[model samples]
Target chain A: MEFLSYTFMRRALLAGNMVGVIAPLVGVFLNLRRLSLIGHTLSHVALAGVALGLFLGFFPVYTAIIVSILAALAIEKLRRDYRDYAELSLAIILAAGLGLATILISASRQSAGIHSYLFGSISLVGTRDIYMILPLALVIIAVILKYYYGFFYLAFNENEAWLAGVPVRTLNVVFMVIVSVTVALAIRVVGTLLIASLITIPVAAGMQVAWSFKSTIWLSLFFSLTAVNLGLILSFYYNLAPGGTIILAGVVILLLVLLVKKIWLLLRRDL
Target chain B: MSFLKVEGVSFAYRKERVVDDVNLELKQGDFAAFIGPNGSGKSTLLKLILGYLTPTRGEITLKGQPVAEIMDWTRVGYISQQVKDFNQSFPATVREIVGSNLYSKMGLVKFLNQELEKKIYRALELVEMEDLINRKIGNLSGGQQQRVFIARLMVNDPELILLDEPLAGVDIRAQDDFYRIIGNINQEMNKTVIMVSHDIQVISKHANKIVCFEDGRAYPHCSQEFSYDDYIHDLRRTNLRIIPRHDH
Candidate 1:
């Protein structure tokens, strides 16, 4: 309860919970579309952006988000060329991103306590970060609501969706940008390395019992929100990194769900 | 006079042309099936018609307009050969799958009204999948999945239906039933249907027109000509089987 009084902890919770709602919200489509790993790739791209921002003396977080968004649009365009072997584009982008990040890190030499972005620090999430996160999170939710079936159909079967006049290309670009911005902002709540876990594991856990797309979303949101809050609270008292603890909480829930499903099946067979 | 036309459509992959210098035409209410051996470019031609690939050298038109210029594809329904690409573990029910087709029209402004719900059920009933509306799509058999897809297409009541290898993994009886449903759709609805298929025998029964692809060329035939050729081919195949007569 004393932790709630701290401004930094409260900001982390607010930002983390907003991320908790969106990471898996976009994740359900990503996993269904088999683009779950794109989150990780874009986060690496975010690293390059952060390095650029550091070298240029601008706010790193803002630069990272803008850079990753541009990278998303580029990836979407490249994705069109390498349709069957779409991962080729991802590999190319990842290499370029990492290469840029390494060079910038070397040239800038501003590596002073940079683990905050690499891992995530509650104290780093300022009032301005909340302003940025809240609006972005709302936009993601609103887009999902507006084009709910379009996104679902694209995930279910993209070519048919194209014929069904779902505006697949436009939706794809919109989706990629959403994922990019999510991964970029999520770096502050969970780290660049661990962000995909928030987008993947909770959805995986939800899919165990989710019978419909709606159920999948609801179940995933439930697991994610719980894990994120639990991780924030646990980290506060136990002195652990919030990102690691949050992802670990998600992983634990996934494992427990698997265990319970297996036991339930076994018991039913016995009857 | 034609509902769809392809003139000198020479489509190539890289430097190698697949559908080369092809000319094809279909009248209104015609069910044209493309049939040929593997790598004969029937599928590529279908993709060209679907505006997926631009021809290296010619023109394709639907209803007097080039497919490239036709922006609104709502009147067109397609079921691709990549049904296998449907993630077997995706958490979508049959109702959701069929109902989602109406989203392009109803997504922004409307919820599931009674008319849309009825439309979904009617499409399902047309494909004999009404009872499984709530069932998860992944749990269905291959044949059942195809039926669900057909139902998905039927929800829109499109004027044009394109299917690529629609019966790849379906069972024998189900294949027959599939043809019946498609035949009914063709005759009763008066919709234009074009399909790429390996099952020439079954297709011949339903298709009013047959276009054979071979060696980067297309040869169009009326049902009368195709039936005669199919009979000769079947006879030759049966005669050749005499050299290795067995339970097979």
Candidate 2:
């Protein structure tokens, strides 16, 4: 309760929850599409973008969004060209992003700010950060609502969607753009290093018990909100890293769900 | 006029031409089966017709309209060779899987209506899977999963159904049932079906027309007797009366 007295704590909770919702929402598709690594890879691209922003003396978030989008497009191209070894494309981009980020960080000598972003500093969520996240969350929700079924169709079977005249290529491009924006928005709260876990952990928890696609999505939201809210409060009291704590919270929930499922199965077998 | 026509169509993956100058025609209600050895382009031809792959040097038309130009894909349903390639751990119920057929027909902007829900059940009923609509798709047997996909295809009332190795992983008993269901869809529903299968004997039992693919060119097999030189050559080696191409 004392933690809520501070304005930074409240802002951190708000921004963290926003990332919580959007990251897992996007993560469900990423995990289903077997592109969970894309989040990790793009976050690295976001780092390079941040470093570039510092070098150019501008806002890092905008630059991160631009760089991540371009990197995402490049990843898509590479995936098409090397369909057999698509993961290699992610590895390539990740390497390029790391190299660029390292060079930029050394050249700029902005070590403190970069370190804060690399591991995340929830205490630093300002008014501008909240403003950026709110609209991002809404846009993500709206896009998901508009393309939910089409996305579901593509995830289940891409060729079927194509044959049915679904605008697959266009949808894929839209989806990649959303992913780019998501990576940019998410790095603000979770940090670039922990972005993958923030995106995937909640969705992984949901998959443990969800029986249907709709339920899985809803459950992912539930897990994400719960983890983010709980993690924020816990971190405030314990002086812990918010991003890592949130991920740990999600992991705890997943393990609990799996244990319950196992116990239920064992009891049923015994009966 | 043929409902679907392929004229002088050739497809190549880079420099390797999989299909070469193939010509074929299908009327409104065709139970046409494509058979060949592995890598012989039967599936590739199906993809070319479905507009999933473009031919390097020819044209494919569905209902006299070029496949590339046809915008309304609700008329066509495809169950690809990778039908079973999805993550079995994916959390989707049979009803949800069947309902996805209506996604393209209804567009993504609209919510699922009661009418679409009723249509989903109707499609499930066609495959006698109404009871399992609530079941997790991954929990079902291979044959059941295949039927659910068939129901998914049927939900939109597609006039042309394309199946690639629909029975590739099913048990023998289930395969027979699948063939019957497909045959019924072709005969009773008056739907045009183009199927790719390596099981020539089973396909021959049900299909009205069989096209054997050899080295990118399609050779028609209208007779019950094995007459093609490749077929005769295979027959000699196997010493069996009915040896499927890939099996031989």
Number of the top TM-score candidate: 2
- Each candidate's TM vs. the true structure? 0.88, 0.91
Give one digit per residue, the lDDT tens place, for model 1 in A3-120: 9999999999999999999999999999999998788789889988888888888888888999999999988888888788779888888889989988987788676645787887
The alpha-carbon RMSD over the true interface for every model, in angstroms, is: 1.7, 1.7
What is candidate 2's TM-score against the reference?
A: 0.91
After superposing candidate 1, which stretches have Cα over 4 Å from the reference?
A: A83-85, A88-92, A95-110, B5-27, B53-68, B107-114, B211-248
TM-score of chain A of 1: 0.97
Q: TM-score, chain B only, every model? A: 0.87, 0.90
What DockQ would candidate 1 receive versus the native complex? Answer: 0.55
Q: Is the docking of candidate 1 incorrect, acceptable, medium or high quality?
A: medium
User: What C-alpha lDDT do the candidate models reach, one value each?
Assistant: 0.86, 0.85
TM-score of chain A, every prediction, order shown? 0.97, 0.97
Model 2, residue pairs in steric clash: none
